[model samples]
Target: MVFSNKQLLQKALEENGTALTIVELSQKTQLQVAKIRQTLTTWEKDIVRIGPQTYDLKWRVYCGKTFRHTPQAIEIEKGILSTETDVYYYLIASFDYRAKITLYDEDDVAYPLTDRKQSKNLKLSYLSGLSKWFKKYNFEVNDDILFTCKDIKTHEFKIRRQKKQERDEFIIAAKNRRLADLVYDIINHTLPKQEGDMFLIRKYVYVYPFNDPVPPDGLIKVLANNKRFLISNIDKMYSWTGHRIKDFLTVGLRKYYLQNDKKDWIPVIIDTDEFGKYGYCSQCSERVIWESDIGWHHTKTDFESAESYIPNEFFTSDNSKTRMN
Candidate 1:
């Protein structure tokens, strides 16, 4: 009763809810040890390897689970204004309140100059710059500048503020003796918190105050939610949870898992001193292009709209959507 690689892996997943080590897989599948490893590499597309030896089938499975859905509200607005000799476009989207400014060359090619962290600051800067740029070029500026703002009337701010408050509560819990002791007790006694010597749950893994705070949930949830948790092309279904489980079982945990297994992972740092500076593109002398909001589309009207002002191709027939929008 020998099973194929796919069938063997499927059986292993059905028996194990969320984690499987390479040694455990080999025992269950009754396949040669070397052959099992080879099969895993070949089938990496469907399988997510969490650590050096742990693996899981990549698919969302809910036996009787229901996830509460709370959709985040998003707002968007766009406006077009006409000057005596030029047209100006403006757009604003909700979330963190950022603004993108683009300058057009003589060929109609748009080069994004800056992305302001605050929307109000962006509006003021652009307004001042537009007046100066237009006057210097002797071009008749359009007075009918389009202005739009969306989601201005919602309680989204309150919701986000509440969530932030809750997150702070959890952070406080980590420091409190009673709460920390209770969490540790649960991990040690009740939960299957250890795989080999490493902590099964990533939250239990300790870090110094200098390091970034541990994620609220265990590595399982982190891997499940983050798209960049696993190797992309090799295992499309690989997730953070799977990666965490794999690392715990095989690599002894404590190490940060990254999509590129060959490279060591670094924590994100927020430096207040270096914030709010304009970043320049090394490839182009013009300001670096920032696609913070409003994706560009290739339309005849959009192209012709700026043809008279810029000498470059403002629009192209190649319809590719960039993350800029």
Candidate 2:
């Protein structure tokens, strides 16, 4: 039976519990060596590199969860003690939510510097209080010490802080104006015509009124509704925004569509002749194409009457409507 990249990855992870080498994963999944390498790279954001040439199977479970664990690395040169201290200070200030900070003496082991100080483990509360310390000292932390945390929590905290910083930066760049105007500017600049043009922009913010979950029914409602959007916008908003669109339709908009009976879930865009003439190739064929094409192909349409499901706004221009007609 055939399996998608997602499915194959899931299977490989399930079969091999913690970490898996690239060679072992390729052999077990029967996937091309190159494809396995590519998948490993794509999955790196979600997976943890336990050792050299080994990846932990975390992506399958924590696909896109906010608190998912990721990997991070910090390097410091020898003799740069001040620089290392400053790095730790900044890290604690930035990620007190999910990271625990600790300070080690010159001996490479942690010990309380003062009698009043609690155990060596730095708590969230202490890290949160760092801003006050920085303001009082007029200088940053030293740079020679090593700091570590629970890998997953550290990753999650970094992701959250980075996202917040990015959103704030965008809002500041956009002159702290309304989201609607930002959206308008983005749409205008990115897709001037909105044909097949696609691009992704990171760092977006949104605002919604607070009182009601559905953002007041009418225009005259007032509440402190605000939401921040931050993601690399892919061309055709549906690629990333589609998930948001789906959520809106189900929960916010109360609209739903029946699922099609076909096995594939992804929407396709291609002509009938193209699909028919190039139905996916069977294995052992003399195609000489890349190994990555193992399970990628256009799905066959069952000749059902195609519906005009494209949004009405997409046809605002008379010329576009005429072409569709």
Off by over 4 Å in 2: 1-3, 48-52, 58-129, 132-145, 151-325
Can you give the TM-score per candidate against the true fold? 0.24, 0.24
lDDT tens digits, residue span 1-325, model 2: 8887657866777777756777776778788878866775522334434344565554332222221111112111111112111232233222232344433322334322111222344211122222222223232222111122223333321111122222233433233234233333344343211111111111111112111211111110110121112111111122212232221111010001111233212222212242231211222111111112122232334332222123333223121101000
Model 2 TM-score on a 0 to 1 scale = 0.24
Q: Candidate 2 lDDT (Cα, whole model)?
A: 0.28
- Please give the RMSD to the true structure for each candidate, in Å: 25.9, 19.6
User: Tens-digit lDDT track for model 1 on 187-293?
Assistant: 33422222331222222221212123322322222223232222222222222233323322221111112112333221111111232322221212122221212
Instruction: Quantify all predictions' global Cα lDDT against the true fold.
Output: 0.31, 0.28
